[model samples]
Target chain A: MKDIWKKFDETEPSHSSIHHLMAVYHLHKKNGYARGIDIANYLNITRGSVSITLTKLRDKNYLTEDENKFYHLTEQGQQLVNSALSKRHIVKRFFSEVLQLPAEVAELDACKIEHLLSNETGEKLICFMGYYLSEKPEVLNFRLGFRQFKYQCQSVAECRLCESDCFFSGKEISKTG
Target chain B: MKDIWKKFDETEPSHSSIHHLMAVYHLHKKNGYARGIDIANYLNITRGSVSITLTKLRDKNYLTEDENKFYHLTEQGQQLVNSALSKRHIVKRFFSEVLQLPAEVAELDACKIEHLLSNETGEKLICFMGYYLSEKPEVLNFRLGFRQFKYQCQSVAECRLCESDCFFSGKEISKTG
Candidate 1:
């Protein structure tokens, strides 16, 4: 558990890099071509940083540019964006539909982690959400009971949910984020 | 959705930095004082790099050093770790307990996103898990039924679980990550 976070650096097409790839995706979809300035505008990043990132992407074999400076995703780049969007889809549905959180919260949270979640987790989440949302009698009963139920953790020691720290009382600290 | 990934920069106590703080936290718990070398060893980072990160942390006012160079978390630093740990706890339980993913996968996935999730999602997940875990007949029935359920997607167009790309069939791309 203590070491898992380190693997984040090993992930391909990291959260920001995926978006850099995705900017190409969305821009190509919107206008059929993506330039460095166009990607910079799309991501709201400065041209200098975007060029550095794009150069890294190109050097890594994820994308390519034509003589006209028109950028395009290679097969690898397209797959990264596709996989990220798929992960985002399931994550958003789980947060919004099964948990019944607001749509905005779900979208924001999913967007933040689209590329970070592992493929196995993404696959399982898709399966779990599909199973949970089925219109079976048990699913219906559980949903109704869940809405009427309230969760109250009396103490950090007794609370299985917060075995580490008490977020319930961390109102002051949460404000810092 | 395109803009949300950029906000990751706005988040303080970033994923790797949180571990720097956590190294201080665990070292303090284990040794009553954290030195520059202690944190570097704890995080597997080189002393030169850890010094740079620790100095930045001090500059940001999240931690401090004393005459002996022992490290300590300020009130704000402690809160950040507390919140991140709390978030990690709930996320782990959600994946391992409620979603019933493998424990190793859950732990890995949760660690990857511990410092990235919003406060709202963390709180809601805790409440939802509490409600879902309650010992009610509806809950039991649903749990039994969910394990028996299977999720099958015929195509991307027909699958609500996969809105953007077909992860179900993307066996080739998943290995890239």
Candidate 2:
């Protein structure tokens, strides 16, 4: 879908750009500021590349650089980083909970999804699923099982139950029933 | 972190390639077979690009193409497509539920995340979150609030608990609590 591509495009950080952003975020989070060489070393990238990225980020008002080679996120930069982090968590939850994907995959996927999702859609989805789980705990188990099987390569038919007892078990029913 | 890049690099699909694959999947799902022109037309991309991507996919044994342009996904290809679809749903749910992101953003984010995540991480995140939600619903609510404040352009200290309670409470909690 065009929409899908658009989403992908929005989140498709130039590999280098994302690398730089992450390095800075990490360094800043741990230390008060980050030096270019330190970031380059951590990222296993060239110092020249880190310098260029830092220059770009500074120009974009996302970073503040000093003579000491140390850099810090500007207010705007912090906002962006926070947003990215939140989106990443959301993506992780989505893969883990709804799709029942494995932890490694979910984390990887969240990195990509966090960049792509529009604010509106992401919020709505979280709200809806959270509400569903709270009100219908029983359905949550069923859905989790279904999602797990689906992730593990089970066919829909294979996951379906044939016996009445299966449906009538102690599991609580929800509106979807 | 290096491992993360390795997975991302390995799974990264060229834009044209993914478009071609999605077109093929859509056409096959709708009509049981996909033609070259049909894919080209649907994607609004050059036939040459489509042809090139198709050739690559063929080389990878993801599809079977005949001289007449008729094509179908190989079992491997079908499996991949199914995985993509499942990821799409997870992404959607994640934005809606955990992040409380808007629908548009969530959908967009999910699309991006689906492509980036490693299968293992994706599955693990889902399983853990599912268990957490079932075992500790309050934690889910806390996470929801935390994410909302963290990502919604508001500082955690700035969030109004009364407002959140009003918004998250009630009988239709399943709808969008």
Candidate 3:
């Protein structure tokens, strides 16, 4: 746990860089071309920042810019985006479908961690979702019971999750800060 | 989705910064006090760097330093740490208990996203686990069926999760780069 946060930086395309690449993919799909300005507009960032990150992405061989200045994700870039997108879907579905969180919170939470999740974990999560959401009898019964069951975790002393904080009573983080 | 990635930066504690505070909390609990040097030693980072971050944390009102230069978390700091730890536990349990992932993998994945998950999502997830893991007959039957269900997702086209990448076939990101 001490240095696991550093592993966050080990992902090939960083969060910002991956989003830049995704801009290229989505813009290309919708408009048939993507340029620096298009990406900046897509991501709602300054064009200068987009240019700087795109140059690094090109140097790393994840994307390419044609002589006409239109950008596109390379096979490697596409793979990374694809991996992230799949992970996003899995986590989003888990939050919204299984946990009954709102669709918007689920999507944003998924986006925050999509590029960080390992391939194995992503695969395993989807498999779990698949089984839990399947048409099997036991799965159906479980989903119904789970939906109707009420949890009664009371005080911190009696709670199994009081090692650091209790989710039920921790003050909400001021997101504006 | 355009700027949702930026929401990652909106968390009160950056991933590295949160761990620095947690180190102080752990060292104090284990040894009854903490100092900049102690945090540096615990995190295996340079002391000068730790001092810089500690100053920033103090300015942000998350921690304090005493006469002998011992460090302590303010009430605000403890709440943030608690929230992050609870989120970490919920995710770790989901990965290991529900998804049946390996312990080490599950822990690392949880660490990677602990501070980033929204508090609402964390609470909802734990409640879901509470019901799913309960001794109710439906839950037990579902667990047994799920443990034995072998998923066979063959390719991207027929898969429900092929919006971008196929987890089963995506190239493992080279963490070394």
Candidate 4:
């Protein structure tokens, strides 16, 4: 299956556009609808900036402004946000559940990554996280290992605590180094 | 650990800037050096655009351009590229080895994700892949399941092919849906 669009070179969604889309989607979820000022306030951007991007989104057929001036995503826009939302869910879960990152860190990391990962990569990652969380019993050990990892991974020459069997061991690196 | 930078609302590297940084790093790796016109040719961008971004990278202390017009990443730039390169290695391995995605697809996906994933998530993912690849024999079946998942995940409704065992099944979603 060749996927030229997967490169997303020319057709890539802008960061701000995707950000605004998610903001609009969440606002709709909370208030049952969204508008320009609502999105601006939610995203902490100026209303004029929101209006400009929303107009672009509308021109691209991703959204429509109703008679009441409430914003609604078109079907295409809904699909876009749904995919992003699902990916964000998986990434956030992976960080929080498997890596033991704090929820806020997980959310921030997932938000940054949701736009960048390919669907295949996202699926595989979610699948792996599902298996890991369900099967693994050493959550505490893993969290401690992360602390150790943070300290020990700084240099190939300076690692002192990793076991000989550890994949990231300085001894292992020295053999190749 | 409060990571304010992860939000990347400000002070985030632009996509073009990251691309240029990687290009310069790769050029240095393969040819022992990099130059502006070489990067422009390699990335298929205009020399003017390359010059503009290279200046930004220099200002950020990620790289330096000599009087001879060759570009060299500083220590900080080298560290940045090394981290991104390692993450790309792990993501590509997971996609190709674990998920059975084609090598090209994996590479492209890895490139896109290399910039976005937090280091902590990358470390956990690499550890999981190491364990899964070394321990699991159901890898083939898992790949087939992914094919099925690809077909079945297009809609939240009418997803009956997934077994009840599947965490992503409609039944699972309906519990919350």
Best by DockQ: 1
Candidate 1 residue spans exceeding 4 A from truth:
A169-177, B169-177
Which lDDT value does model 3 have at A17?
87
Which residue pairs collide, candidate 1?
none
Tell me model 2's lDDT, rounded to 2 decimals: 0.56
Model 4 off-target regions past 4 Å? A1-11, A126-177, B1-11, B135-177
lDDT of 4 at A119: 58
Evaluate candidate 1 and give its CAPRI docking class based on DockQ.
medium
Best by lDDT: 3
Q: Give the Å shift of residue A157 in candidate 1.
A: 2.9
- In order of appearance, the predictions have TM-scores of 0.88, 0.64, 0.91, 0.72
Residue-level lDDT of model 1, residues A12-128, one tens digit each, is: 767788889989999988999999999999888899999999999999999998999888899988888888888888899888776666888788888877777777777777767
Q: Give the lowest summed-lDDT range of ten residues in model 1 chain A.
A: A168-177
**Tens-digit per-residue lDDT, B51-90, candidate 2:** 8888889999888888777988888776566555555565
Error of 2 at A43 (Å): 1.5
> Taking the tens digit of each residue's C-alpha lDDT, what string does model 4 give over B34-79?
9988898778878998888899899999999888989998887876
Better of 1 and 4 by DockQ: 1
Of candidates 3 and 1, the better by DockQ: 1
**At residue A172, what lDDT does model 2 achieve?**
28
Candidate number of the best TM-score: 3
Worst 10 residues of 3 chain B by lDDT: B168-177
Query: In order, what fnat does every candidate score?
Result: 0.63, 0.23, 0.61, 0.17
Per-residue lDDT for B137 in model 3? 94
